[model samples]
Target: MVQTVKLMKNRLAMYGLVWVLAMVAMACSSDDGDDNAGSREVKFEVTGNFTGQLNAVLITASGGGTSESINALPWSKTITYESNVPTTQISIAGAGGDPGETITVKVIVGGKEKSSTPGTATNSGTIAVAAPSYAF
Candidate 1:
């Protein structure tokens, strides 16, 4: 009878261990369908010698997932996109420069300024900053 009890105790201990490991495995398993899985907030800031020349700026990120226009100078817009998004686009519009005249454009992402490149005012004095790679 003592031997049987001892065997039963050993089985109980083994069962307890198995139960703990199973619980741990369940805890470690990730639910890929989480709503916040790829979520992140990205900020785009438009600034420059806008002065009276700057009228409105268009910003788009994540393939139109987030887009808006700023009708004021030194404007900023914050948007959220998946961390996997590759790039974003910006466009600046104004009424001061000549058609097709070169204008300076500045962009800031995540509170840090991005490098400037040559942008030209359109026939309507609009300029585009195409597909800048998004920073994760």
Candidate 2:
């Protein structure tokens, strides 16, 4: 009986020692130096120019070229544009959202429906936002 009691006490001590060692290791191995302390990452930017009244414009994207889906885009608007003068001061909010994604821009001039020819987006590609974040 005493032997069994001693065995149990030894096991208890070993367990306590292991627990203490584990705690110490965890504390010492922690990120003692702020790994990401001062490092900064770059956002995305989406820039483009479209002529015509720009009846409507849609910005799209895809990630890893998988789904081929239009990741982030805008809706259609009912605005009339002039003939000679092209649209100016055009900027999208969430085009530069996620990186490594495919982007597509669609614009309709005169007629309705998605069948309208889509205008080129100046190859903004994966837009990188560098300022205040805008939620869509």
Best-fitting candidate, scored by TM-score: 1
Q: Which segments of model 1 are wrong by more than 4 Å?
A: 1-40, 49-67, 94-104, 118-126
Q: Candidate 1: lDDT of 93?
A: 41
- Summarize candidate 2's per-residue lDDT along 55-81 as a digit string, tens digits: 111111210111011222433333332
Which candidate has the highest lDDT of all?
1
**Per-model TM values vs. the true structure:** 0.41, 0.23
lDDT of 1 by residue, 9-54 (tens): 4453344344433333334323234443333454555654443244
Candidate 1 at 123: error in angstroms?
Answer: 8.6
Clashes of 2: 13
lDDT of 1 at 6: 48
How many residue pairs clash in model 1? Answer: 1
Error of 1 at 68 (Å): 3.2
Superposed Cα deviation of residue 32, candidate 2 (Å)? 65
